[model samples]
Target: MDGDNPRTPLLSIVQESYLPKTVSIALKCILVGLNIASIAIGVIFMNECPGQYLIPYYLIISGVACLLFLCMTCLPCVDEEQVTSVTLANLCAQGVLLLFLFAFFIAGNVWIYSLYHGPWNDPSSPEYCARVLYLYAFWIITLCHLCFLVLLCTYLCLLLGLYILKRSIFGSRSS
Candidate 1:
């Protein structure tokens, strides 16, 4: 009603989280733990193998990137008004980083899978890679793929449910 201040959607924005705070915090903690474990595994792998392969390096770099992404997400959006440019920028940056990391992880998958049958624990063999290291790397990437598929399916289901609900509500009015 006031001419001086127009009521806008951006101005009325509230800092509401998409996930409950407890759930979000718990998920972040789990991701942080996994990333740290991956980094440690990579270091152990490098020390034990000391080969020219880039698998260990890939593990380490991905772990670090995930950690960095987590930190960026944790940053508080100072400006709550105007769709929060700071938050938007942070999200966009995170998205780009995620795409790059996904591609990087896929490359790692190829590298690891191609060498699946290579020599393990054979010091004398030129292709020697510790059994433990190879197995761990193999399983970790497998787990990542499994998790991605589960999440993708869940998201699609959620979208489908919303679409059905919208159709039922609006379709009744038009009939």
Candidate 2:
């Protein structure tokens, strides 16, 4: 392939193949719904525990970012060159952000679980229902974060593999 008119990057090819028109639309819709549900649950948990702002805040931000990503995916993939840079950059940025969010969600879940599952693990406690609800909400948020993290990792790995392949192929030719 000519250097100037290079083939579409492997990452873009994988994304396009995996997320075709029907699949992309469906995935986008599902992601939006999940994000909205997770945000609403996070808000409810936040109301119960005003002092714990970390999880809910991150949850809100992740939801917004996911929506933005969905919108980006919807754009027509007209020019391969135009889409490559923006899509790769967006993927990398989102992957990094998701890593941090994943860590926060894991920590938050553990902390919340410890707080509610200790000596105060009594059903008779007046706030027991609220505690359970909060825990459940945190669990849901953690699961959502986990899903996104998995997707991010998959894309990153594909991108890395493609990069290495391209390097070896071009390097051998140059030699």
Clash number for every model?
0, 0
Most TM-score-accurate candidate: 1
* Model 1 agreement with the true structure over 83-121: per-residue lDDT tens digits: 442355666788899998989998998778877676645
Q: Write the per-residue lDDT of candidate 2 for residues 39-70, one digit (tens) a residue.
A: 77667666444334454555566666666656
What are the RMSDs of all candidates, in order? 4.8, 7.4
Query: Which segments of candidate 1 are over 4 A away from where they belong?
Result: 1-16, 47-52, 77-85, 117-126
Full-model lDDT for every candidate: 0.77, 0.62
At residue 119, candidate 2 shows an lDDT of 39
lDDT of 2 at 10: 68
- Residue pairs of candidate 1 with colliding backbone atoms: none
